[model samples]
Target chain A: MKAATTSETAEREARRNRIRLMQGNEACAEGALAAGCRFFAGYPITPSSEIGEYLALHLPRVGGNFIQMEDEIASMAAIIGASLAGVKSMTATSGPGFSLKQENLGFACIAEIPCVVVNVMRGGPSTGLPTGPSQGDFMQARWGTHGDHPIVVLAPYSVREVFTETIRAFNLSESFRTPVILLMDEVLAHMREKVILPEPAECPAVDRLRPTGPPEAYLPYASDRDVSPLAPFGSGYRFHVTGLYHDETGFPTGSPAKIRQQMERLMGKMERGAGQIQRFELTGAVSGGSDPVDTLVVAYGSTARAAKHAVGEARQSKRSVALFRPVTLWPFPEAAIRQVSGSVRRVVVPEMSLGQLAGEVQKCIPPKAELRRVNRVDGIPIAPEEILDAIVA
Target chain B: MANRIEVRFSGSGGQGIILSGVILAEAAAIYDNKNAVQSQSYGPEARGGASKAEVIISDGDIDYPKATNIDILLALTQVACDKYTPDLKEGGVLIVDSQEVLAIPEGNFRAYSIPIFRLAQEKVGKRIVANIIALGALVGLTGVVSRKALEEAVLSRVPRGTEDLNLTALRAGFEEAERLQRAEA
Candidate 1:
């Protein structure tokens, strides 16, 4: 018994040493494993393919299922099917594949299914640059699916953030009963960094909200605590779910009154719970406890890392500059941005796309506040020096 | 901050330039407690097309992970050198494998012509270990990293039994650097 106990302790220590240099996509796969994701279905696409490869190699070892579907459409459908069967499912793709998955994504939205989809963004329009980084998918993630539906999307700037936001994506999807997107660019997806992974004991796992009462009384779409609980298929709550408008019993309904109520409830949970889902980080914005003199740089994803560096350089030259990075892209941080408007004179928005987030910032900031955009759509990150020059000039 | 060295590895695909940058970044970040970031390009055509990896090491917090100006340039192909040479700061170091890179541009920066292929053939008897050989020579020339730390990093990175072969390649690179230093002195 003593020998067996000692061996167990040694095995635990060995597991702890799993910390090694890993690419961002690989770390994301490891994060999904820790998030209790049992089902991953994806198609092979540049940049985002590494995430699929990692899952294919490691998922079975941990008793999870990894499937490579025929294409993005089938991949997304399988994830939704797996999630409804009481499994935490996820799918990842790039710009072209993300475009193909939009129809199924709309299906998930209308069905109010819980799953996570990762878009490791690359240059776009149509397969522009498969390996290069781009943030052209910002507007697409928010408004890609048809109809008026609310969604949650998170952007991770570093490899470490990729790991954490993936877990958050699963948590939010399960809690809200909606498909959550974890948006990453090719730079963060391909770059290798030293990620300090959390110990198993430190990570919190969120399982699907199961029904508690008798199976006969269970209603899959019935509201409770502002969010409805999901009933597994074999659990006897054999309610029909469809892409068409549904009622409280999960059956298709054509009544305008029922349709209006269902849509409101579906959108209300994410809209009302925006405060809890939003996350951002600020640097150099509150220096010397006074109004920021001239420029405030707003960037996200890999571009935010460059913005932080530019802000630091500008400060060294006695220039008053700051950076505002949105960790959560959707449910746009209007309140936090309004706060920034009160303190800054000018806002400079730099992105890998041509003013996608800049347009969002313009809507949020005060009208009188000057808005300058440093836009690049060439599948490369905006350099730090470029932003610093803009700040200094 | 003043003593930190940032090196960039650039070459055509199949040259293992990304792995070389990774080894250096791991040596600096994990073994030396220095802040390091490694970025590379990936694509379907990366096997024979242009490929590059950039490593930035600093004593202070590295806010910008991308390298704008390189301190050392390891160009394995002419196209790689032509693309990146303009980005090297003045008086920077350039190391080229003699067999692959035929022309060395005249500049104030120090240039070393190491027989990386020949050394790989002689020591490890494999062209794939050419990156390990170049990395060894890089350690010898810069002395920014200690041999022991690099050896430990190499041992930890390679396959289970190939640790000794990599270590030998690293030592051969160190000797090549020492010999060059002695010749220059």
Candidate 2:
């Protein structure tokens, strides 16, 4: 993928500032467009197929390129190649397709290339329920690629939230210089809602930091700076990128001291930027100076919506329930969760999967507050009534 | 305020069950300034399948977006009505095509049997717009959404040059609904 140097020119042609009824997948595509994504390569899969379809139809009109790759692995490779060419790129897929892209996802993580991978989660050990909703990929999203590489994952609950979060995903990927995962479940990917999209000019987007130094002086993996600024391939800066543990010069090396330095810096970028990437919403008593919340519900994606509604309904019935919605799923916002969970007696983690997120929440909160989990794997999105019942009972 | 209403549109595929649900949701959300979400049965949500599309409209943010306990059901087929009727809330409204669905199930929810598709074919000159006709009758019977909002919403989404036919079907649907309401009373 040759770098299209027309992202600025393309924005002039994009549909700007309009309120329209949009599905969640369409919102994600629109968000990618707003974030100046200029390249898309993906194979179609249920639920997530709409994202690729929407982009295929509209990307060219905005002067971006959308290719239907031979398979999911090629789709993943193509996006990384485009990103290296200095263009923002993305791919969308469901669980099985996502599983196929894992090797390249590991490649992108080890190489520290900026890109976005949208996984619209579905039931699966393997093609379990093609069109149904599932958060079963929560662990796979973070650890599926194999290795201890840092990643940023954002989950949006509403159509509007998905739009903004997609843009945030691209911005985070660019700023952090890592591939960011916009983790969506089948429910959010297929549901349609009214979204008032902001004008293109109003969207805040970040381009990857580039090296301003002379080509000979460039160190692609240098840890002296907070982030190693990347220069586009064929842009007069000659550099080598390898998945192997490389020193600052982007070449392969096997020295223990050098490998440790590179890994720590790779990991430390997320550790230092966790505050910027961590986004969560605290609702109910946590929002006011009322009595301390006895139960704090920690949730994400579609489950969080049900949790929020349950908290609202419970508050009406004189229950001390609060909601902690993690807009950012990975680089798990443990500090914020811990803080809001301070006054609460217990933290309830509800998810479509069987205790994926709950296991992580359990590790963060003190033992003084019990950690409770409400899990379902029947491929049905968790109903709010179930959360409400859990809250009251 | 609990201005939340759940509406389900069920029929065979290609009848625009999903589109009609979206139109109803857009009318409430875009034109009437409400929070609305529409979702459909995922696996076989295509034409000729047992398809049902649902919309939840609320004055506030919606939680539990699916129509677990439907307040209104527009069943264009007997199969749709039979498969979906049990989930209707007590005192909810069930609107069915009287011509297509001969035996209506007895339930606590009020039932309105109107020949929605036949009326669309006879009055509007096209049976394909039956979903729009059913939508019109739905607005007329339940008043869940304003007729003006629904009209604008339909016009915005429907194919170009067919607005007048859809509009006619909508009006005829409203008339049939009014006639049924008077007869039932």
Best by TM-score: 1
Supply every candidate's count of residue pairs whose N, Cα or C atoms clash at under 3 angstroms.
0, 1
Instruction: Output the worst ten-in-a-row residue range by lDDT, candidate 1 chain A.
Output: A285-294
**What TM-score does chain A of each model score against the native chain A?**
0.94, 0.94
Model 1 spans with C-alpha error above 4 angstroms: A1-19, A223-225, A287-293, B1-4
Q: How far off is residue A41 in model 2, in Å?
A: 0.4
* Candidate-wise lDDT, in order: 0.85, 0.88
Report the C-alpha lDDT of model 1 over B59-168, residue by residue, as the tens digit. 77666678787789988887777777788888998988888888887776888988988999998888888888888899889865677777777887888988878888
DockQ each:
0.63, 0.67
Worst 10 residues of 2 chain A by lDDT: A8-17
lDDT of 2 by residue, A223-321 (tens): 786588889998999999998889999899999999999999898999999989998888888723667889889889988888888888899999998
Tens digit of per-residue lDDT, candidate 2, span B1-185: 27778999998888888899999999998888788999887344565777778999998768778888889999989999998999999999999998989989988989988888788788977889899889989999999999999999999999999989888988987898888788878
**lDDT score, residue B120, model 2?**
79
